[model samples]
Target: MDLDNIKDIWSQENPDTTPEISLENQKELHLPLEKLRKNMRKEFWSTIVLFVFIILFLTFVDFHFFKFKIYVITLVASMMLITAFYYYKFFLLYKNLTSVDFNLLENLKDLKFQFKLNEQYYLGYYIAFVPFTVAEVILIFEFIPGWKNLTGFSFILYLSIFCLLMLGALYVVGKWWFQKFYGKYFSQILNLIDDLK
Candidate 1:
């Protein structure tokens, strides 16, 4: 065969495989995406159930102190509201899993944005609990007779220290919870994105 004919044969024989490789990468993404969606849905439903139980308890149980009841109910309601908002945000992310409309890089960037947004939401969610923590301390002092012994600067000192300690503990616990629920999938998605590069 002539040189041009040989070149034509070579070109046709070794057609570009880029599209095939892209399809495979898209397939690879589905597993992690499904896992992330499944996990989010599970957490969302569980949170709803928990808040329902809390609402029922708040409705039925009569704590002798009206202020205690008010504080506890308010705290639970606030938590439920925050959780609902986050879950709505999460659901939006989950819906994106079904469509592979974006290229791999774009998807990775979007996922990274979601992960960071969620981390912020998680921190804020925990921070929201601080007020309730302080209220609990206040209720104990006001209603629980034994705590009356702690008064003046001693009371101020103890409450301040306790609130700080509780807030710190909450931060740690929230971090752990996020890691437990999300760390594996987050790492997997990151690795996949890196592999694409």
Candidate 2:
């Protein structure tokens, strides 16, 4: 074939057409997206308040041992750092959702991916605290007067069991919390995508 003829055929075969969401579908998407954004805002602000309360409580509360206060404050500070990282990502998604033009199906798909990715991040945020929890527990045992009575293998065994149980509980609670806050809206978005498809 001549180059001119081949070019024409290629142009005809590959039109620059992207699937656009209909106005009706865009309207359908608005509710769930708004719900997700609202929930995110509420959670974010609540977390900030809770952290502030924790810091104040730690600073002002009377503890028998000074080391206990320091250790907890340090752990809370570390948690705040980790939380800041995750919230930065969360804020990006919040911004994306806010700015969604809903013009293309691909945009919705990308938003869905963001939701799923952030869901994983949410769980990781919880799991990340496991070490902090363990350390805090150890501090409690060391500094608290009552726990001093437990000695040797008994302390080790109890701490191990408690940590194991806490690990499982965190995972379960994380899943539940996600479902309660965002999963329902996520389901709605998935349904909207399916309808669009």
Candidate 3:
């Protein structure tokens, strides 16, 4: 066959797969996407408010040790910074969902990818606090006179156990939290994509 014939055959076989979304499908998608965006916004604002409350509480609460206060404030500040970073990425996804110009199939695929990526970020956000939790535990042991009785091998063993338990709990909780807040919407999107296929 001539090159022109081959080209025509190829074009026919692989017609544009990413078509514009129909008004009906877009309307169907509107609810789930809006729910996801709404939940994200609520979570973001709640986090900000919770952080503010924590800072204020720490500032006003009496602490016998100045070092403990400083350490906790610094830790909270660092956590806020990390949370802000993740939220920025989430905001980008939110913006994409809001855009009117996206191609249907391609955009759905991209959004699905973004959702999976963000789910990892969500888990990482929790896991990232492991070190901070350990530090806080150390601080508690140091500042609280009652906890000082643990020493040498006993202290190390207890700390190790506590950290392990905390790590597992954080992972489990992170998964549950993500599923509770966002998983349904993600599943809905996946179903929509399947329908398109």
**Candidate of highest lDDT:** 2
What TM-score does each of the candidates earn?
0.77, 0.90, 0.87
Best-first order by TM-score: 2, 3, 1
Expressed as tens digits, the lDDT of each residue in 59-150 for candidate 3 is: 78998889888998899889888888988988888888788343567777787788889888887888789888888788877888988789
Reference-based TM-score, model 1? 0.77
Question: Could you tell me which residue pairs clash in candidate 1?
Answer: none
Judging by TM-score against the true structure, name the best candidate.
Answer: 2
lDDT, candidate 1, 66-145, per-residue tens:
87788777877777777778777777777766664535476566776776677677677777778877777777777777
Error of 1 at 95 (Å): 1.8
Kindly list the per-residue Cα lDDT of model 2 for residues 5-111, writing each as its tens digit. Answer: 99999998876777899888898899888889999999999999999899889878998778777888889899999999999999999999999779887788888
Q: Provide the overall lDDT of each model, using Cα atoms, as 2-decimal numbers.
A: 0.75, 0.87, 0.83
Model 1, residue 15: C-alpha shift (Å): 20
The reply for model 3, stretches above 4 Å from the true place, is: 1-17, 100-103
User: Which clashing pairs does model 2 show?
Assistant: none
